[model samples]
Target: MSIRFAIVGCGRISERHAQHISNVGELVAVCDIVREKAEGLAEKYGAKAYTDLDEMLRYEKEVEVVAICSPNGLHAAQTIAALQAEKHVICEKPMAINPYDCGEMIKAAERANRRLFVVKQNRFNPPVAAVKELIDAGKLGQIYSVHLSCYWNRHNAYYANSWKGTKALDGGTLYTQFSHFIDLLYWMFGDVKEVTAYTANYHHQGIIEFEDTGVVNLRFYNGTLGSVHYTVNSYQKNMEGSLTIFGEKGTVKIGGQYLNELEYQQIEGIEIKDLPPGNPPNQYGNYVGSMSNHDHVYANLVQVLTNNGIIATNGFEGLKTVEIIDKIYTAAKPL
Candidate 1:
């Protein structure tokens, strides 16, 4: 049985979700405030389009899944509405601006007895998956600290054209881009006990209220300390995202785009030695770095729903990510 999907907010990322739904499941409907954008996606996928989500839900009874791709701030409300309508939801990252909204959304899903998945698709990367497998197998025993870094160049014009630059809409670099890495941090490590962060708008001078550069210090529940360093300023446009985990038996370093580089060293007796090489793809050619590979995650989600398995990034996971972001932002605020 194919899962019918209705996509809300036909923005830039909605195109990727539409493509995936058309390829993997039934693309039942598309909705957006802008009629043209919604209709455009509907036409491409042979699905109906609506300017209003309520109308779409009422008419498209086959839409069992709702994909919320709206602005960061609108995610919680839209997700709760979708769940109340008895539809499973797949919300975009930065689940909500704050933990309260996230909790409300989760409560709605629980009340409706529906599944709510969050788009932390970065974890689906091949290299990242491999590292996770190793960690699960206890190759890197008794994990210690982690260092995560994301440095990408986003010009002022990029934020100027969309609702991305404002705190009221897109949140910030922490919400917009680094949210994935932040979730990955929790996914691999667990809830953070405490966070201290500093954020500033040193670059990308504009009329925006969010910062382009920020640093966060994290103390995990297991007594593992970590640091996240992020910035949206670079001269030649490059992406550097890496996670290094230290353990008692061995230490693992996964670097490069999407954590595509992996190196493991075992502390055997006298000194440490590097393990055999893991698959590391070239940095330049992966066109659809993280966002474009929605098909893989979507397929897994469909199977989970069909087989009565648990959704990978469910509403609780979404809320946890939001809570971490809320704490980080709260700490980063002016003192």
Candidate 2:
């Protein structure tokens, strides 16, 4: 039986979820504050359309999974509500704007005995997966450090009269744009033990309430140090989103527009073989971002829901991502 799915937001990211969910799941309904957006997606999939989440969940009770593509800040509340409604949830990245909110969502999931999955699709990138395999195999011994860079452009036009530019909804660049990179750090390394950071709004000052540029220094529980330098201040387009790791025996670099390629590698006895091309990065009207692997995420979701498989990005993992971001933001003084 196909898992019945309903989307809570029909925004830009929902395009990815709607396009691929039909393969392994049935899109039974779509809900959005904007009725037109919900109707648009609903008509395409022949699903019911709703203007409110509670209305959809109340009437379209067959929905087995709630795929939340809502704004960053709304993820926790929406996810908890869906869980309380007895539906499994697959939330878009950042999980929530804060660690406490994420904790609440997780608690709700536990009480409802439902799964809470976070979408970290980049983990499905071939290079990323291969690198993870090496790390797990202990080929990269004593993983010393990691360096991450994310430089992209988000002009004033991108935020003009939009919820994205606000602190309450979008949070900041780290939440909206670089959360995936932050997640990758947690996924690869263990819990972060320490963090120091600084942030700035050099370009998008009045346009956005939070920083458009930031740098973070991290120390993982294993005593491995790491650093992240990210910005949405690139002039014309995205500059890079790359992650390089140095280990006792190997060094690897996963660099590309969206962590798509295995740019560099030097392992003692292991060879990085021919890797298949990865899914393309998401392209908005004028913006581009992390790899578009929602299909892979859906596949995993289907496996977990249908075959009782484990989630690659579970609630705890999602909470950790938010917690790390919270730590960084807390460490950074006013920009």
Candidate 3:
């Protein structure tokens, strides 16, 4: 049976979701406040376009799934409404502005008895998958510390159009770009016990009230300490998502997306001797290096719905991520 999908908020990323739904499930409806955006996507996907979600839900009876691609602030309310309407939900990242909203979304899903999946598509990258496998295989040994460096460049104009630069709306870099690293951190090292963070809008001289640079220190529940250095200012414009894990027996470094390339050093038996570092400037050489084909996440969502498999990033996971972000934001605020 084909799942019928309706997408809310026809924006930049919604196109990717639409392509996936068209390929896998039946693209039944498209809804956006902007009529032209809805109509454009509706025509492309052969789905009805609506300006109001209630109208779409009432009229388009076949829409079993609703993808919440609206602004960051609207995600929780929209997701809860969709679940209440008896449609499963796939919410975009930074699940909500805060943990309370995320919890409300999860509650709505549970009450409605529908599945709620959060789009943490970065984890789907091939290199990241490979790193997970390596860690699971005990190649990294008893992991202790992790260093995540995400320094990308997002121009001031990027946040000029929408609710992006505002704290009440977009929630800043910790909510936007560095969120991938936050999710990655949780993926690698389970729960966080404590977090101390500092944030500032140092680089971009804009009216928007949010941070463009943030440094976070985390203490994991398992006694693993980690640091995340995130900034939106980079002169070279190179995107780097790298992780270096230090373990009791050995160390493993996976640089770039999907962690496709690896460098590992192991110290044999209780000698207490340090093994030489694997490589200088260990560049996984663009491991699995290339942009991901669009619709990758949507296709995966289809599989999850059809197979009744566990949602790798479910509503609970989304809420937890938001909780962590909230903690960081709180710590960063002035005392």
Which number leads on lDDT? Answer: 2
Candidate 3 stretches greater than 4 Å from native? 257-296, 333-335
Query: Model 2, range 19-129, lDDT digits (tens) per residue?
Result: 888888789999999989999999999899999888888998888999999988889889999999999999999899998898899999999999999999889999999
lDDT of 1 by residue, 42-117 (tens): 9999988899988888888778999999999889888888999999999988788888998898899889999888
Q: What TM-score does model 3 achieve against the real structure? A: 0.87
- Provide TM-scores for the models: 0.90, 0.98, 0.87
**What digit string (tens of lDDT, one per residue) describes model 3 on residues 1-335?**
88889999998778877877778888889999999999999999998999998888888877889999888888988898899899989987789989999999999999999999888766765556656666676666777899887767666666667787887778777786667667877877788888898777777766567777778888899899998877777653546667788887666666653333444434334221232222122122221222343355666677788876666788888887888788888877432
Least lDDT summed over 10 consecutive residues: which range in candidate 1?
A: 279-288
Better of 1 and 3 by TM-score: 1
Number of clashing residue pairs in every model?
Answer: 0, 0, 6
Best of the two (2, 3) by lDDT:
2
Question: Which clashing pairs does model 1 show?
Answer: none
Q: What's the lDDT for all of these models?
A: 0.78, 0.91, 0.75
Pairs with backbone N, CA or C atoms under 3 Å apart (clashes), candidate 2: none
